[model samples]
Target: MWKIGNIYFIAAVAVIGGALFGFDISSMSAIISTQPYLCQFNQRGHDENGLCLGPTDDVQGGITAAMPGGSWLGALVSGIVSDAFGRKTSIQLGAIIWIIGSVVVCASVNIPMLAIGRVINGFSVGICSAQVPVYISEISPPSKRGRLIGFQQWAITWGILIMFFICYGSSFIPGTAAFRLPWGLQAVPAVLLFLGLVFLPESPRWLAKKDRWEQAVEVLTLIHGKGDPNSPWVIRELSEIREVVEFERANADVSYFELFTPGMINRTQVGVFTQIWSQLTGMNVMMYYITYVFTMAGLSEPGTNAVLLPSGIQFVINVVMTVPALLWMDRWGRRPTLLVGAFLMCFWLCINAGLFAVYGRAPYPGEFTSTAESMAVEGPPAKAIIAATYLFVASFAPTWGPVSWTYPPELFPLRLRGKAVALCTSANWAFNFALAYFVPAAFANITWRVYLIFATFCAAMFLHVFFMFPETANKPLEEIEEMFDDTKPGAIKYIGTPAWKTKNTRNLALRQERNETLSSEEKMGVSGEHKESAA
Candidate 1:
């Protein structure tokens, strides 16, 4: 709640960490398409007449999908690393790997070398995505926690937009030298992230759990300097950490398979499905084939349209929308905000699908092909559909896009958070890879069905939230532990309606109307009747 210089520094560093993941998402797509890089290299492996020679179609797909592949591995490993080495070390390692990957990509002479570089970078991004939010959540005060964690997503969107613009601007600079500049420029943030970590204190909650009281105190001092280190605020946080640790110690040592045990099952389902929902919404699909999308709408070219203006705009919109997530998160509560946003996403994607389905049929003459290339089409109607889709991207950025990342860290209990996040977040990368690898192929074959598929996913998630996602706004972390219990069947259920229930429960009606009835009953001074109703 209080504005402090230290909070900004912590947020800024966390954002830089976020940027590493974001930049990688869009940066390589530009590199893959740039003629000076991709085309000339193809010619290099050609015969005397300049024809295909090195790295066949399958090899190229592997190279392009390198980061996603590595991310899957990195995410799988992040749980052990974050839990064993701590969040700081995990992030520091990610930065170092990212820098190496950037160098490899920048200096790569062949597809294999570039793919190797991307794999290294992808590993780093995976670790960051797994650990950074956990760190942010530990350090943040609950009041501002959602918004601060939301910053990671906001930063990611900005990073993607910035990378796109850099690629766009570089493309016009007239040579391979220009394209190389953008690849090289990516190294800067990674370098900064590596350097900035020197000043950052490790998570106080993490230290307390480890029984490093002196270290935890120092970290707390860093967060709440000039204010008494032993102030009630500081003590309250320490107590919460102790309670979390105690709770962990009390639970039986459950295996991963036990994640399906009733109470725990809901969160696992939410974590896994929410991530799947994110990809199925077609965000990654749009990202992977923005150039093709633009071209399909008759916007691609030997001219300015090659720049991926629609994605670039969406990136900027995402960045702008992220600015308020931190503030509104505490104000609106996570479930209401997330549900509202998810519902809006359903509406927007469905609308975009309808528009595209209506006008995007009947491919351009001679442009339609069996191969995975944009079917160049054009007109006012086409432009309208493209415009609508870009707006859809903007909507996603602020809502499901960022909320997906923030929710998992906050919702999961401390002991299992690392493993759960690692598994769920990796699933995200897996879906990302699937989308990136198959979207072009899907579009060429399935046409507007791709958008329809996304719309269906978003709609399903909207209904799921209306029925299940709990309200976690201003409540203290300890109070929400009940939601994570394995014994409570509807622990994940929010305060809503009886019809929203997954199974029949007699209390559902009273629970839904509990608040409205309480005030009126109190106004009439019917305390006995109110007491009887609660019973």
Candidate 2:
């Protein structure tokens, strides 16, 4: 494997956990709405005749929310698990957990059984969500780091898109198999992930940090330079790993409290709140309850197929937009992406709120209410609302979705990286849980007014990124520490500069670009010579 190619293969396989996480997202939402699921568990209860037994809003919220609650605890503990067992093993653990969860959900006989299953599966997702990006970030070369980690977010969206279509197909299934078959199929990816890990190598940097220098050098040779131990690039990268490890070993006793001190608070705030704003972008609101939102937007057809239009639009647009976003990520500064996304998200939400207010009257079905109560708008206004939602998803998928996946692992120093990322990931799930639980009530009570609250948060987040979050594009992990150092009160002048323009990041990016060009030229020259020799 020459030039990090092996790293890409491993990352792609490892992020299967992310795909399962994404599969669970749309699948559960799709299931809870079906007549079989509702009739069986909706708490409205079946008479001897088994009629009028649709699930209550509370049951809907519970089934939808169970995973996030488990995810929060899973994320909170993932760092410790990774640190104790290494990144590869943590991934394996998650896969095993995923298999168990899928079994429970698919076999469920009641709401409690299904909810318990969701929570278990959520635990698997929580661990993978935090650990996968960390693993990818640790293994990736700085020049290609953003793109590699972006794969995890891409895999997640891919899973969601595929699952939505699967849900579409499953809608034709009669009885409980519509949901059960999809839940069972979700386990396939987890099994693949577990089997794949048996052959892959651990993170070279983690091996170095644990004082296994020989193994680290061996992996570095293979991934960085096709197994040439004497290769200059291999030697240089290995040396950097050793140096980083030594530096971290000297300051290795990191505590959670230390993250809040004056010298570290800015980094802490940036890492923690990036996750917060991502959820606040209202992306999950749509993701978790797109069926409800679509119904309110006046989309309907017979069976679960009513979801086909909105779900298809979401899947295609997200999968397509995300590819280019990853390409632009390292070249364009991270701060600009956040700021732009926040503004556009705010704009779209405002438009949605305005359209709903003008086109539809009150008795608006709140967030918690059924679509029957909320589907008041018709014709053009209804279509406009649907368009607004797609726009919102468009703004979000490219910006917050992938950026949130990459930024946290880049924010902390080596000594505290694991804990910080784990904590930050937990924050993401915590907010996810809050919205998953409360959005129903929010929609039911305030209706269109709900968008106003999220829109305001988007405005605040944009300003925060402009003044508070320093740009981190193209900087090496060590250079990131220098950027945070300048965040102290007396050094605030450096905060707003584009990371690409900062002295360290600029020099590094230029060097990386030059090397890449030379590499391309050399390969082309060799190709030309080979053609001459063959002829």
Candidate 3:
């Protein structure tokens, strides 16, 4: 049967799972302020002009957060599913779930129905987001692994950009169909992803772990050797993978409890916190609720194109900026990208917070709290906040954006890769759920102070990455374990030995020596057979 043999094509097709997540993001962001969505789902009833007042702060947050809440549960179970079934199968399952959720969301008539649909969609996102990177990392060559995994983030940005425009177009339609059209369309990419997976290869490392040696070699040959099973690079990779898998099989059982053991605890911390810090950077707050942020900037009334168009620009910026990371993350290295990203994000968030604190007006005593009136700041100050937001996203798109997804999956062995990444992704969604729920209320009550909170988070994340994250760029998955093992306990243990300081030459030399030994044995066997025949 024909299957996708090209690695880049495989990465591109698989990241449609990430796009499903993007679709969910804009599905809410584009329509949350629309009259049809507000009137249909809001329990609060209509205002003086008969425009829907929308749900109260708490209800709206729940509505927005429902998907990530579902995703949190979905991520936890995704490890089990992927481990038992396979990466490609798990992603196909997620695509099917997303289709079902899109149907529910399109048909939603009330807050509960809407939340339920969003939760279902979140479950699908949870499964895909955790596993896509793992699959990509496993199949990719170590030299290009960062670039390939970075595609997941790039795909996410594309999903966000595409869906936001779709929602923007649908918003002009009459009644609930405005929101319903885009919500229903969410299944389109999920459908594409399902069909696309039929032609993609399973992860080679995953096959090796299952002891299906021939199939594993075939996959590695397809990906790395142009179909030459005897290629030196393929032989070296297979050797490294088999060595690690055999050792792991002899020594360890796959267990969640094992992740917390002393030998693994540092990796667990780095993996889990890498995701936690990604969320706490407050980038998603922009993705999930950009309209709200712009509304406070007094761009226009909540549902107007004035607000939507500018918010759309951020999506474009997100997509455009991610290209740099895709092109050069392997060269730039992960640790530096993360550290610089955090620092710049801190700088941008502080500027945004300062603008709001200085120029924004508090809500008038009788003004409706849910509308832009509650925290309006117009003219130059509002514009500066918008600029700061764009800069903040620019800071994030190339740096933490891709690195966060790429870093964690590289930290574990084949035995722990699936579950370990799921644990980390769940941390991402847990905070995603909290912030999605909290930010609306925070905006309503605390105003500019919210930006300050995230700014502080970015600062702390900078410190965390500097101390805890070693560069995982340009290192083979089987060899990354050595970096952790080599760390000695002391004041500088947190910094560890940098990944760049370790040379790939050592592994290359070892593989060369092994190849020479194998060749000598083959020649000796041939000579002995000839001697026996002559005798």
Cα error, candidate 2, residue 448 (Å): 0.4
Q: In terms of lDDT, which candidate is stronger, 2 or 3?
A: 3
The residue pairs in collision within model 1 are 147-326, 263-486
Q: Quote the positional error of residue 141 for candidate 3 in Å.
A: 0.3
**lDDT tens per residue, model 3, 270-374:** 999999999999999889888878877877553355678899999999999999999988777788888889999999999988888899887554334374335
Higher-scoring candidate on lDDT, 1 or 2: 2
> Model 3, residue 148: what's the lDDT?
88
Using Cα atoms with residue i matched to residue i, what is each candidate's TM-score against the true structure? 0.84, 0.89, 0.91
State each candidate's clash count. 2, 7, 0
Write down the lDDT of every candidate, Cα atoms only: 0.68, 0.78, 0.85
Taking the tens digit of each residue's C-alpha lDDT, what string does model 1 give over 1-535? 2333386678778668778767777776565555566554573353443323334434545665678778878887887788777777888888888888888988888777887888998898888887888888778765566777788888788788888889878877765765678888998998888778777888776677677888787676558533346544556667777877876777656346656677577778877776777777777666656666666776654324354665577667667776666556566555566567667766766765666677665554444221344344458767776777767776677677767777777667777677778778888888877776776667667776777777778778888777666655444455455545534344543423332332322133234334433444454456567888999
lDDT, candidate 1, residue 408?
75
The residue-level lDDT of candidate 1 at 417 comes to 70
Q: How much is the lDDT of residue 168 in candidate 1?
A: 77
Best by TM-score: 3
Query: For residue 149, what is the lDDT in candidate 1?
Result: 77
Model 2 residue 261 CA deviation in Å: 2.8
Model 3 pairs whose backbones collide = none
